[model samples]
Target: MIRVVAVLALLRLAAITVAALPVQWVALRLGSSLADRLPVWWHRRALATLGVRVTPRGTPSSERPLLITANHASWLDISVIGSLGPVSFVAKSEVATWPVFGLLAKLQRCVFVDRTRRSATGRTAGELGDRLAAGDPMVLFPEGTSSPGDGVLPFRSALLGAARAAILDSGHTRVVVQPMAVVYTRIGGMPIGRADRHRVAWYGDMDLIGHLWGVCIAGGLDVEVVWGEPQIFEATTDRKALAATLETSVRDQLRAVLRP
Candidate 1:
């Protein structure tokens, strides 16, 4: 039965992924260089098990301390980007409390920001700066929350201010603010439209179990990613203006991907 197979495949996928947690934790503690990409290999297999096809475009910068900013559609964003290269995410603090995913995020060494607590912002900003200075490429979803796959939401400027701080406080003008777009292109061999996006996008109030069930049961989903031009956050660049520019670039890519 379709239900049985989907459930079995999902359970198997989770089991394998969860089983690798301790190894990742040890790697993080041991200060191994392989720590950067070990989790990505795990994610590739897990995503392959789910029958999702991810196609990426352009190239992420190889330069040290790159800061990638992108639109958030679903929890799948993590696997999609993780499949690309060696990178960690800057996520909200609450992600650490989520059941399985929170654990995985920690294994991946994701930077957590408590957006509601003003004091936490400075602390998180310091961590981000340190990571950048240490030469780890970090990805951030500037929408501050995930949205339906219809289009990109206007990016918030608060978090982006951290990019500036990284350059000024750390004296590392080497950060690349690369903009990217993740578009869910198809489901069941047909192009997906706004009407069907909710199946992939996990907006607030949507039950995670039911959403994951819907995605796993669906046939042959397709995802396309566009890596836009990388821009530098210089001393003169205003954070709000930078966010608007990147948001436009991402929205444009989404429009192109949605074209018939």
Candidate 2:
């Protein structure tokens, strides 16, 4: 029965990828004005393929210059949140060169940054700010990498500088930073524990294809997306301090949501 489900998912994924072409072309041709309202369809398609149901908490921001910081759980985090609303992602620089996922990220207008190079940090943040100033809300995973569905990692303060630049220089003082937490709660309509969760969260050195295979054969993938209250960053606020606070809030939220 599980094998049958996995095969079905693989077929669905292939079809969705093909169907996204026209949508991508039209959105890009119009200067990406349709961009902020796009990608939800792809997220829906991804959900259908992966058998993952995302239950969102708290409302997304209604204003421009929004930054969403989510704890990275599985690769599925992308589709879960992207499916929630139309939002771009701040992914690692190597993602731009990845196989098929890279193209999808570019189509979604993702901002890629090279963490090893200090020179690129400002450039990447500038790009993020440019998108925000252009009224595009972006999602950034501050852990710099995905972790097992165990606990939220302490966020790196380096990337939070992007939020500071946008609010201070761009005159967008009230920019909203929405902290999000993703927790895989159940499988096959039953509760999943730490050992079983490995089928979902793909961490260090985990091969993508193998992870997908394992996930596909598993029961349903259920993710709880908890969005913390919207925080307004101003010039008077210390950026790093605010970032740390946001990190703690999100970590707490994740722990709360994951409590058994």
Candidate 3:
């Protein structure tokens, strides 16, 4: 355990010291394509170092102007999902102000929304539309928060408004909304029950430092990422209905993994 934690600490220090600065400079000078790819590389390395294994079941949409709506489980979800492809996230504005994570989010070019302001969605939607049109796959956690991993929470439909904005702002007739689910299935090659899985979830009043320590010690953590069938968001599409469809797809996928 001590050796694993030491290796992880060294890996983080090396990444921040040796790789992060140069990668940031390259992404800023070149463009977002490089920015998109660098995070995937970093995330894969982090997962490798931490012994977290990810099994991605389905493909992310190849369609341009894509919005992938996923259920959130833990802070590790970012690394698990990021390792899959060149994707940016629709994160809450507060994440942009966090310590090391804030810097990482900026480097990844995540779109930050102030969820407190009801009026902000329209403006964020415009930004999301522009990003989607530009060929960036944007990930939105419609649940708007992490869950306990036992089950998914009800998705907040208001965030799905960005899909509507994509159609209107980008001049696209339709946008593809893909549903995704992330589930933690095992630790040390043994299946984790609901009671044990909560230890992997970083929610509520959990302290970030403590959770980081716990994750470092948790061995052979296995996660599954499943992408559901894509839905088209058209001008006439109902935002609430779209959100409900995504929620059901994600919930079903998660339940599949939790089942024996």
Candidate 4:
């Protein structure tokens, strides 16, 4: 029965993706607003098909040149966050080479960064800044990598340079850097304990195909997305300090959900 459910869920997701691909392509060519919105619609529908319920707490700021910093736990974070609004992501370059997901990420206008190369950092920051200047709210997982869904890793300060870059490119005196947290709290209608969180998390050397199949078969996932206070990021703002502050905010929010 579980295998049947997983197979059906995968089919539904594939159908949706196939249907949306051409529309997204045309929207991109025409520079239509649909290009920005269709991903959100697709993500919401995808989550529904997977029996994943998202509970968003607090509101995302409406500020322009906005950069949101969030903790990463699973590959599901993309769809989960994209479902909330028209937002792009800052992802590792390897994601751009992924089979189907890479295409989806490109359609969503994600900025891909080659993290292995130190010199690529500035270039990626500029690209992220350009997107932010174009009025796209960009989501960055400053944790640099996904965690085990039990705790947030220390956020790296390198890519926070995008905030400074946004100010320079957009002619904005300051950029709004908002902290966000994504926590998987329940699975199969029961509170998911710390030990069981690995089922939802996709970190380490976990096989993507296996993890995705497990999620589809298990279903009934409940996720909490908490948006923290928005901070004004100026040109002179210390990147290390700002990254630490945002990290603390996300860590606190995650703890509140997982512990309380």
TM-score on alpha carbons, each prediction: 0.96, 0.94, 0.93, 0.98
Whole-structure CA lDDT of model 3: 0.83
- Collision count of model 2: 0
Q: Summing lDDT over every window of 10 consecutive residues in candidate 4, give the lowest-scoring window.
A: 161-170
Q: Could you say which candidate leads in TM-score?
A: 4
Q: Which digits, one per residue and each the tens of the lDDT, describe model 2 over residues 143-196?
A: 889988778887887767755775567777667788888888887787778888
37-131 per-residue lDDT for model 1 (tens digits) = 78888878878878889999988877776889999989989999998888899999989999889999988889999988988887888888888
| Candidate 1 ranges with C-alpha deviation above 4 Å | none
Write candidate 4's Cα lDDT for 58-156 as tens digits: 989998889999999999999999999999999999999999999999999999999899999888988888888878899999988999877889999
Q: Which rank order by lDDT, best down to worst? A: 4, 1, 3, 2
- Least accurate 10 contiguous residues by lDDT in model 3: 13-22
Clashing pairs in 3: none
Per-candidate Cα lDDT values, in order, are 0.86, 0.81, 0.83, 0.91
For residue 88, what is the lDDT in candidate 4? Answer: 96
Q: Write the residue-wise lDDT of candidate 3 on 101-197 in tens digits.
A: 8888887889998989989988887788888888788999888888788688988887677657655766788888999999999987788876786
Candidate 1 vs candidate 4: the TM-score winner is 4
Those runs of model 2 whose alpha carbons end farther than 4 Å from true positions after fitting are 32-38
Which ranges in model 4 have alpha carbons more than 4 Å from their true place?
Answer: none
Candidate topping lDDT: 4
